[model samples]
Target: MATLMAVMVFGGAAALALYALAATVLPQASRIAAVLRGQSGNVRFEPLSSLVRAERRIAVRRWAAGSTMTAAALRPREAA
Candidate 1:
């Protein structure tokens, strides 16, 4: 009976601790994974800097008219 009680207590405590940690971390983990996968829309991080930067370091420009824009415009506005 004592052994059974100890096992139950230990199991319950372990389960509770696991649940608490998951509840705290799962949302952040999912968000980070989503950002890494380029699936997040807003790219917002609460109470801190955004996961995505204001300016992208690399950009791919598509020419719909089969003509490229001037290098001045193609470069970032700040770079120009």
Candidate 2:
């Protein structure tokens, strides 16, 4: 019973220490440790839709390269 209690207490303390380190120390450490020179004043990221579209194009190109059948052959026939 005593050993179990000691283990639980120590485990909890260790967890708290780790959480404190991540929550408080990590962000400041990154900001302080790195020195940056400004190259661009504005930073713009590509929209999610555009990124997904680019990835889809890449996948289609890969599929086309690997497959023996042409894309037109893979399409379903039109109903009469």
Candidate 3:
């Protein structure tokens, strides 16, 4: 029972310390990180069109490859 209480106290202190550190650090960290993101004065949040285009291209390529593989597998093995 005493051990359990000790563990709970230690865990709570550790959590609070971690939370305080993160709270102190995150704002400065994010500001520095955002600079690397190269945000212009105007930041627009929108879905990227290029992502959708690339996804479609990948899907088409996969479908073509799958069809070719299936056709090749369906062919009878040549007798030796």
Candidate 4:
């Protein structure tokens, strides 16, 4: 029973250590992959930019409709 308990504790510690290492490394690995792909012109920015713009438009519309947290009052007026 004591041997079994020691083995379980050691396995759990090893698993936790592996998880911590992966959490630190995976994001940096993904970013490096993105940069490498971008260098080959495979990364597209327009879709992301358009999505951001659309989200902003939605937020502005929501604000104009009197949703206080969306900052509708901060939207600039369009000139006639």
Question: Largest TM-score belongs to which candidate?
Answer: 1
lDDT of candidate 4 over 1-80, digit per residue (tens):
99999999999999999999999989778667877787543455588899999999998897777755456657788999
Going through the candidates in the order shown, the clash numbers are 0, 0, 0, 0
Task: Please give the lDDT score at residue 31 for candidate 1.
Answer: 76
Can you write out model 2's per-residue Cα lDDT over 1-80, one digit (the tens) per residue? 99999999999999999998889977766454543443344444669979899999999998987788878878899899
Which residues of candidate 3, in runs, are more than 4 Å off? 31-80
- Ranked candidates, highest lDDT first: 3, 4, 2, 1
What is the C-alpha lDDT profile of model 3 across 1-80, one tens digit per residue? Answer: 99999999999999999999999988778566777898554455656877898999999998888876866687899899
Which pairs clash in model 3?
none
Candidate 1, which segments miss by more than 4 Å at Cα?
Answer: 34-80
Error of 3 at 7 (Å): 0.5
Candidate 3, number of clashes: 0
Better of 2 and 4 by TM-score: 4
User: Which window of 10 residues has the lowest lDDT sum in candidate 2?
Assistant: 34-43
- Lowest lDDT sum, 10 consecutive residues, model 3, at 39-48
Segments of candidate 2 deviating more than 4 angstroms: 35-80
Model 4 off-target regions past 4 Å?
A: 32-80
RMSD values, in order shown: 13.8, 7.8, 9.0, 10.6
